[model samples]
Target: MFSFYNGFKKFAFAMDPETAHHQSINLLKRFPLVLSEVFRNENLGGRYGVQVGNLHWDFPIGLAAGLDKNAEAIDFFTRINFGAVEVGTVTPLAQEGNPRPRLFRYVEEESLRNMMGFNNEGAEAVRTNIIDSNRNGKVLGVNLGKNKLTPQENAKDDYHTLYGTFAPLADYLVINLSSPNTPGLRDLQQKDTLLELLSELDALRLAFPKPLYLKIAPDLSFEDIPDIVDVVKEKKLEGIIATNTTIMPERGAGGISGRLLTEKAALVRNKVLECVRETPEIQVIGVGGVSTFNELWDFWKAGGKAMQLYTSFIYKGPKVLDEIKHGIDSVMAQNDLKSVQEILDNINHISKP
Candidate 1:
């Protein structure tokens, strides 16, 4: 499989990244189970399962949003063995995002910079895609965002509409206010604004409830993390996804992800975890720059549960999942732990990666 992907990567990487991404999505949209089966991890079973809010993931790592912005290829992603699949940054209407050269890759660094300003096929089409998808019992989350044209005051309305549309369809839902490409999107991350937006959703949530999470940025002030945690607590959210990609101006425009985001993301994750330490119900879904089993180990040590990866999956492919699964097995064997729950139960006592 590794060799196959390497050969495939050589071909895929030769093309423009966005072009290659679209081609991959187009192929998956054909719904070829044979191709999906080739990448399936047969060993992923109940033992690897972990709980994230009301939803249960077959494994820890999930495909983050952006890869399938339209949820056009759910069958391939679910079957490929990610514990969960999240789609969108979807808005109420379709968008073309930024112009050409929006996706830039840092090959040697295993990083990516995207200025893709939440471009997606809008709610109705995406809702149709979600209805048509085969989740394979793995969790599916819809990451929602306001339309690029939506005024900041009307942002809560967009979210309210999105939550109502997706709540019944997705196993979980994420309110994505942290993507850097959209103008003034990150401003919603401020404590007062964050609280206001979520508070406005209270009625809609009561009408059609789902496991909800907030995806924040790594560039936030560390001092403000607890206040964000407070907002989560105040609004009765399921958790926070610590981090969407981060801004790196020196690298030029757009948000930086992958290896370029690891350290800052880790710091933010740790800070959020610390703030939520006393409130175990408010879990943190780790994302951004997390690529290895050792990093997963650190996350567990700090009380994190499920994680999501996009950039690493791009650079290393399915083998990365195998590596983490093996790393878990090694720790389980060394500590006589039979399940991921057991490993988490005795995370400190288990062998580090």
Candidate 2:
């Protein structure tokens, strides 16, 4: 499998990154059944189940948002052994995103930079597509974003609209306000702005309840976390996803993800975990920079309920998902633990001192 992925990477990387991504998505959409069986982990069930909110994940590793922006290929990915598949950053209206050359690869660094600007087939189309597939038993999520043309002041409307449409269909919903690609999007993460947005959205959510998580940027200061946590507590939101990507202006435009984000992502995740230490109901979905077993363990140690991957999936291939699950199993066995919750329990106990 590794050799096959190596060859596949060589071929895929030869083309532009976005083109390669679209090609891969096309292939999955084309041969969903065949590839699903080829990549499916037979032992995933029972061996590594983790519960997040009301959902039971086959494993803790999930595909992050932005990969299947339109939810066009959920059938293919959900069968590929991911415990969950988050689709979108989808806006209310279809968008073309930024112009060409929006994706760049830092080959030697195993990092990616994108100014994609939340391109998708719009909320209605994405919701309709996923509904058509019945999600194939996938633990699905929708990452909602405001349209680029929409002013920041009215951003909550887009989020509310998406939640109303997809909340009933998805297992969970993510409020994506941190993508560096979208201008003024991250501003939504500011304490005052975020508080107002989430408070209003939380009210509407009461009518059609679902687990809603906020995805924040890695560039936020440690001081910025508690205020966000305050809102999570006030709104009674499910959790926070730390993070989106780091803003690296020196590298030119766009946010840099993957290896470059490992440290910062962990830092922000730990910070959020610390702030929410007393409120266990508010969890943290540790994302960014998770490519290896040790990093996964560290994220668990940081009190993350789950983890998501994107750049690693791009650079390493589908096998990493199974690798993470098996690695977690090994850790559990060595520690005399029975489940992901047990591992978290031990980590919490140790952190107390």
Candidate 3:
């Protein structure tokens, strides 16, 4: 599979990034069941089982948001053996996203930068796709966000509408307040704004039950993390997805991806883990610059309960999943650890600053 992907990349790289993405998605959708069957074996490689809240995933590695924002590829990805797939940054209404050339590749860095402003086929269209496809067995998480044109003060209403519409279909809900592409989106991460946004969402959760995760930025100040922790605890949210795309270094118009942000992500993960470790109730999902097995191990070592990927998948293809899962298992065996959880417990003690 990887050999073919490499050969394909030789041609795909020449095309525009967004064009390549659409082409690949179209291919995946054409033979969804066949693709899923091809990758379904346990030995095909991925962390076999991981638990988050009430949901139990078949693997810890998953395709992140922005890949299938409209839920068009849900059936396709499900067949491919991902433990979970997070779809959307879906808005209250449909959007075309940013203009053309919004997605760019820095081949030298093995990274991608994009300012795709939460474009999607709207919540209602995505809901119809999911319902019609009937791809419900695999764990599915829906990432929700406000429209680009929506006012900051009106953001809560947009989220509330999406939550009500998608919550019944999602195993988990990710509040995407972190993507740098959307204007004023990251500002919602501010202490007071986050508190209010999450407070309203928390009240909504009572009427509709599902795990809620706050997606945060990797570029946050040290002082801001504790405030986020306070809000999570106060609102009784299910978890936090530490370290979204970074806006630092000013990579033109969009946020940069891949290895550049790994250390920063780890720092934030450690901080959040330290703040919440004593409480032990808050779950953490780590993402950012994770392209190697070592980085995945480091994320768990730093106290992430689960981890996700996006850029790495682009660089290494599906083969990276097998490599990381096998590497983690091998390292666990070398240390005489009985399970991934035990390895995580051992490292959590040693990796802390």
Query: What TM-score against the true fold does each predicted structure earn?
Result: 0.98, 0.95, 0.93
Shift in Å, residue 269, candidate 3? 1.6
Q: In candidate 3, what are the lDDT values of residues 236-345, reduced to their tens digit?
A: 88889887888765678778778777888888888988889878778888888878777777767656667888888777767777777777668766776655656666
Best by lDDT: 1
lDDT of 2 by residue, 1-353 (tens): 66677888899999999999999899987888887776655565465666887788777888999888888888888877788899998899999999989999998888999999888899889978888764567689889999999988898888888888998888899999899988899888998999888877866798999999999999988888899899888888889998998989999899899999999998889899889889888878889988877777787776676789899999888878767776777877677777777776787543211
**Pairs clashing in candidate 2?**
none
Which residue ranges in model 3 land beyond 4 Å of their true spot? 37-47, 134-136, 345-353
RMSD of each: 1.0, 2.4, 2.6
In candidate 1, which residue ranges exceed 4 Å CA deviation? Answer: none
lDDT of 1: 0.89
Residue range with the least summed lDDT across 10 consecutive positions in model 2:
344-353
lDDT (10s digit) by residue, model 1, range 1-353: 88777877898899999999999789888854876766656577678889887678889889998999999999888887799999998999898898888999999999999998888889999999989988887899999999989999999999999999999999889999899999999999999999899999998899888889999999999888888999999999999999889988999899999999999999999999999999999979999887888788889998998899999988988888888888888888888889998998997776753
Which is the better candidate, 2 or 3, if ranked by lDDT? 2
Q: Give the range where candidate 1 is weakest over 10 consecutive residues by summed lDDT.
A: 31-40
For model 3 the TM-score comes to 0.93
